[model samples]
Target chain A: METPIEGIQWNSLGFSQTKTDFMVTSRFSTKIGRWEDLQVVQYGPVDVEPASAALNYGFSVFEGVKAFRSEDGSVQLFRPDMNAARFKQSAERMNMAAMDNELFIDAMCKVIAANSRFVPPCGEGALYLRPLLFASNCQLAAETEEFTFVVFASPTGNYFTSVDRGLRVLVTETYNRSAIDGVGFVKASGNYPATMLPKKLAIEKGFDDVLYTDSNESRFVEEASASNLFFVRDGKLYTPDTSRKTIHEGITRASLIYLARNELGMEVVDSEPLTVDMLKSAEEVFLSGTAIVIARVKSLTFENDADQEYKYPSYEVGKQLKEMLMDIQNGKRKAPSSWLIVDVPSLPVQDQ
Target chain B: MVQEGLYLESPREDLDWSSLRFSYTKCPSLVISDIDISDGADGAQWSAPRAIPHDPLKLEPSAGALNYGQTIFEGIKAFRHDDGSIHMFRIDENAKRLQRSAERILIPQVPEEIFVRAVKMCCVWNSSYVPPYDSGGALYLRPLVVATEPYLGVRSSKVFRLVVYATPVGPFFSKPEGLAVRLVTGFHRSYPNGVGSTKMGGNYAPCMQSMAEARQSGYDLVLYLDAKGRGLVEESTAANFFALVDGVLRTPSTHRKTILDGITCDSICYIARHVLGMKVVDDEDLPVELVRTAEQAFFTGTAVIVSPVKRIGHEADSEMAVICKSLDLAQELKVILTDIQFGRREAPEGWLTQVTPSDLEPLT
Candidate 1:
């Protein structure tokens, strides 16, 4: 396929949508229940209700995990079990049905098997996997009687950090990613729609992202609209715990918790109620997610409370943690036995 | 299938049109004084159900129901009496439920008398479609209220449409056995601070993914927990839950929100407390796990009056169990409720709304 935009560094850009290979699908009926006819159908437009629960009320949940191209010309998904577990959690959060872990794993395997070639060779672009579930009943009333789940794959280079642009995030009082009791922790579709306006305004203000504060008091840092936030100060790692009201606990964020502690011999504290002052005092800062595994934050712009600004010491992705995470993910460094799933069958694919 | 005692009259729009179909049926007769259009059109003509085409509705893309989710609906069934009389089971309750749904969803109030009249008129007009009482099939009534306004805004629609469609349904659960439900992890169907208790269109859309996943996972249904991820049990996809713990009947209580205070659920609570002499509990404070340990668990709705849960799966907390007692309790309630609905047993005062064919027959 032709490049989406000319004159751009192709390798630096994450696997563009033009390169997305295949998707796995299934149907549900009262008679047959859940039936899977796994195929690598080309990705295309889906009919969405304008007042769909997801569109109007944020009633969808999603998970992002990746398939890796191993050194032996075989494709393997990294801790798909974790993704399935998290997917179930997300599904439940959105009041959707939960996918049995075994079925979820099987579906992911089917996608990887169908698009084996797209699982980029080792050290290249990782295959991004997105599992989406949403309401599908035709009942015009608020009560839904049906639903749909799909797993789509995209071959991408990397996320956010590849741009090498410093992030100028504005902390705004006007917008909050999620209010208390909202579907913030889950990857609900409505959550993203709510963030679009504030995010657009922040981008127009020359910021890469916006850091959302608590919807109630606008006090502590919650998360970026898309990714979870992480900070390091005085050689100690600090990240928001999942217990707080709203935030998507990204898989990469959890992985880093282990990487920072065991692998790097650093004391990693995953849950700390952070504020703008916390960012100002931070020695290092970064964000984590499946798309952008880890991206460093250079500065924080507080639009609320007097528009104050704070900059971190380092603008580059932390070499120690990044290398450590990448090493384990790419099979360069040995992962704790519990973290690796080496025995799983790898689908036949291109050279790794 | 013919009911000899049901009655019908000319549609009157002066009263609140209960749903989309009812609103359509009364459009032509919508006393022009009742016309409340402000958007400045020709103030379009209204037509009866027979005169209107049965194709997909002609509505603006950005209409209220499509944008702000300004819609409410009720599910009811018309039963054929043994004496060839047609009756609606707990229609007044259905009206009250619709009213509550409207109030919660911020839609205009629908009067009880108009709602009953519209349903009776439709039943009379389609009397031939009512299945035989012994056939175990009844006509399912779906009364929907949607916003018809063309403007794109977050507020309620100025132009509202109410409609009712009838379908013959045999049984919601054809399976001889009970359903298996998995207790969801950290997901509440509705939240205490959110729109969980309302039967709004937006509420159901979000749950489609979860229901699809559950059915995919070899489960029949899902029982979502509250927002805190604790074991605070909410309702299933479309039904309310009740438990027979020890000898006391228990159900989740609704405050501002949490679970839809289902009409059937309320009826069951009434029967159990007043008639069966059973202790009833509606404390929304009880954790869901406590109910799971109850002697029996059952679900209630308009279609499947009461059904039982056989299994509960807690994927996150590594908990999964099957409660045989719940199945037994569900069967017990099903028999009682079915007997009352089918007219084999006596119902509480002001419950069943009897209809005569002559009452619904069009006057020459």
Candidate 2:
């Protein structure tokens, strides 16, 4: 029977260790090693050795995928296969064990089926799925042979903690997110921690997120710490593609390209050498991710700017594109059947 | 003329030790001795470790080495031979790797001769911990170098410290059969144009969090690939990888990023290719599938000389099991290597260097 989640208020949510219905998990042991113990389970704290490699060395990778509860009460995953692919890519990059795609897909289905109730109803919110992998050995010389993989889910309303009119991005020249030959491309923990110093600086300067430049030149636009950026000039969409140095391969950004070209008939260029001047010329600027399908950019502050400032024309939430993306995601419009999957089990029933 | 640097004091000789355990615990006895020097010799006895216990050296939180990861270390075991003679294995190689690491991290260089002397002095001072030959243990020596200069920028450290510490340890692996391996697909351990080739503490620090994640998910270790996501292979967090594919021994080359040039890895390559008459290729030109499908996949390092890789995981390919008789070959190699280090067997090309009590005739 399908689990019912009636009268559950999800607004004003925070990340806490609360009891949950299910999670996706996998294990690698010395005996069998690598690809083993792939499964989904009820949510809880996993027993980890203090000497595990991840804690001391930051040897872990993760991906954020969302399951949407469509209007017809069906749970749908958007480009989950791509997430699986990237998950494997990240694991390989970190030197951790790679998860089998079949097992990963099965685990995802099981966890989403078990927690379908937590997936906010269509048009409400998204069931945020975090698929994580890490090294777990106690040996500390330099290399470890132990590892683990897990996928957890949370029902979230918005990715950005605070939803204001729009957002202001401080262009950081002193700080870098990742080096060209570094772990920047992988969604590894180390990549995120490196941004802490810069992110903190941006927050103190009263900005929503930081627009990081290239580590070497500090001239070209890289990413906005978390999500891929999209700029619309004369109604044409443009985004930065993955280079040897940067890591923002946004699934939502990819989806927008399809939406703009196939549905709206707009020229959607995927890769470009996005510069501050190009960003300034853009009439519409937005961020895309699994959590925030699309968000408008209010202003940009460059260190080299006159009075140390440059602003975008759009300070308000992007109206048309947001509706189009969300409408398709919520099953309000007829999606090109390829976007939807079916025959999934019902979610666990929960109390309000 | 004296070289200018930090001042150090020796350990107080009057401390009582009858009741205290000698085992190295999590908390060390407050760095009882330290010293600063700017010069040393070249060959056998590089330099002595000056003892200093007071006014421990201080460093800026954002020191170039801390933020940019400018550090290097060498692990050499002091084996107490059956004849009661103390000896070291391939000290020259360790010193060279240390210099290479320092260069990569953009730190000051330590002459090879000076490095050997400091390690020798530290081992002699802590000689009580050197286990008996029959006791299945040896004195583990770690010579660390880190930037200590006061600076907030990301450039190389203008000043650094060379530290040596010794502790007795049993086998690196608790089990005799050696460890199992897990192949990864997601994380690249190191990359080209990155610091993967060096032995920087920064490189190790970034891997800790992921290592934790790997353990929780149920794997023993991780194997990172190259950035191209192609057939390019690299070393693990601490060790280098080697495999026997169709009777040929192969491992990733150091031409790309994402690998540490391990001493053991080099030894195995020499023995397998030249001594054992096996085909060997150091570069990543070989197919990754061939490496994974090999009868045996093993990692080499100073502590764990050879660990067998049991299984490999990938999103695309099916899981493959390793089928090498690793124990038999590994045991033989381990015996040969350990014997040479302990002076039980004839030195292979002058690999062992004896460090007698007479070497410390004039103790600092």
Candidate 3:
């Protein structure tokens, strides 16, 4: 077995980034018409034109995936193919060139393998991979002829570091996360910045995050700032309809739904529109995302009804689900073999 | 007199200015300013503005501008008068608009003084690129601000950089026949409480696919409606829409904060109301149906200036209506605006800031 890096305090890792050794990158241009071969380079600053479309017009898309160090010290990726497919969709929505799924998966595997030392030990943390595609050429107009794709890694523990009891959420009717026909369904870089202000306001009002309502009617619940939401009523799971095209179809949310129905034998209502009233009456509510694997919602405060608060008494379902999912992720239990990509080849550390 | 050698070499002599299109023709230098807030609250400071050679910018791979769209920009033009002096048109408005955009996305606002000074310095350093007055070209100035911090979280950056560059551009729409616009109802450019009003990078890229698809269908531009299905006119891809209805200039109100506050649209409205003695209805809700019966229609922005719309087609309704054939009003307004910009006509107070060699004396 290869020795892990010496300096990292993996036990105290938070969601913030810890610098790693190497990253993978590729470039595409109109003249080339295809992505160049992936190159492993030192993880550091990159040079881009000041007038590039990525900086000037927000022509960028990104994906998030995590590679885990299992119980036996073997590194494996969880559902990277899903992330690659979504990355292509996001790039297409942003009008930038998208690398094929095969190249996308290959680049992710190479970066994870190169930074294998940074992957935390089992039960501590995971090496988070961020794959970004952006327009790299300088243009005054809202278009670009050249593009760049980079896959970088950071070791992180958990999204919510201190939320052991559960999260307190605020249901906001004033702000909308995305429009009906907007880029909410895609992982465009622009969609996230707009939520920063709303999230800050929610935090100021003493809440963990804001639960956004639809922009058109403001009567239905959409999603939290960064993750997908699920409501458990009468032991049946209800979530927002991603087919509405205004909600991001989170990969973690999909896996949890699959686990709830197939593994736990629970009744799952995946496609129904969970309204504010339904959320208020839910017995248990939770959020799912790549960063926040699964977080229980203890209470929700609605801004519309004189600051009415709804409290949930149980976190049993969420706890069980998190355990089962993590068990699958850590290679503790038997499941579909295709869910985990094991046997990632590690490259020797190069001198910086 | 100021130093004459402070400027770069004169504009390229081999190129035909008349044949230039609305594209980037690199200038000699650009001005930059940076702000850092990483130390503490009181430790926030903006670096002294500096002019550097035109080159690519170095940034951390995880910059907020690249990962989360913390970027905003403004566009202004410098026109050369008959006497060979260059003057920028209404730069103060662009500066204020940029500040508003910055505040929306939580970026540290570039001080109005710094923005104006940097743009003037950038233009003065590249004054030779200000095309000849008779060539119908202008030095287009782009002022951009981006968040440069390397944090992985979705929050405002502790570091921000502002870069101002210049490029010579001809008319945005070279077609003398006028632009053919398609009324797009399928995709909404912006929503009721969204960031459409800001000149942020986020608002533009998402609309490009819609604009490109429109172009492929034999149209020059796409005119978007309100996202709420109110049948109200919003704006074009990157410009504000206007119609000459019943001898009054009508445009969508910006009160909803769903459309950009266009500088050229304001200038045109001022001309229509005060200079040309025409009633301007800028605060009213312009319905999409109004274009079908309007006398003339046009789009206004820093790029387009005032390009007349020849026809508007609605695919859902199966209607193709010609707004105007002669474009008399659009032509007249464009001429008046251009004359004021080039120092031929009397400009309103604070309408133009003439670029002189003295503006670059401090740098020298």
DockQ per model, Cα: 0.05, 0.04, 0.73
Residue-level lDDT of model 1, residues A125-235, one tens digit each, is 676777776555443223443455667776677554553455677777666655455556765544443454566677778888878877656777888867888888888
| Lowest-sum lDDT 10-residue window in model 2 chain A | A11-20
| Best candidate, DockQ | 3
**Which residue pairs in candidate 3 collide?**
none
| Residue lDDT tens for model 2, A231-296 | 878877787767654756777777778777887788887766677668767787777777667767
- Compute each candidate's TM-score over C-alphas: 0.53, 0.54, 0.96
lDDT of candidate 3 vs native? 0.84
- Candidate 2 local Cα displacement, residue A229, angstroms: 1.3
> Candidate 1's residue-wise lDDT over B168-238, tens digit each?
55566645566777776534455443456666655664566567677777877788777655567778878
Ranking by lDDT: 3, 1, 2
Expressed as tens digits, the lDDT of each residue in B1-364 for candidate 2 is 1223322222223432322222331212111122232342122222344533222234332233333344466777777788776777778899898887655544556777677767776666666556666664666777777555533212344556676666566555544555555555555555444456666554665554545666666556666666556755566667777777777778877865457777777777766665557788886555566766677677778777666655545324455445455555556656766666677777668467676544544434
Docking quality band of candidate 3, CAPRI definitions: medium
Q: After superposition, how far is residue A314 of candidate 3 from its true place, in Å?
A: 2.0
Candidate ranking (DockQ, best to worst)? 3, 1, 2
**Candidate closest to the true structure, highest TM-score:** 3
Residue runs of model 2 more than 4 Å from their true location after superposition:
A1-7, A14-19, A30-34, A37-40, A159-164, A306-308, A315-318, A337-343, A347-352, B1-202, B205-364
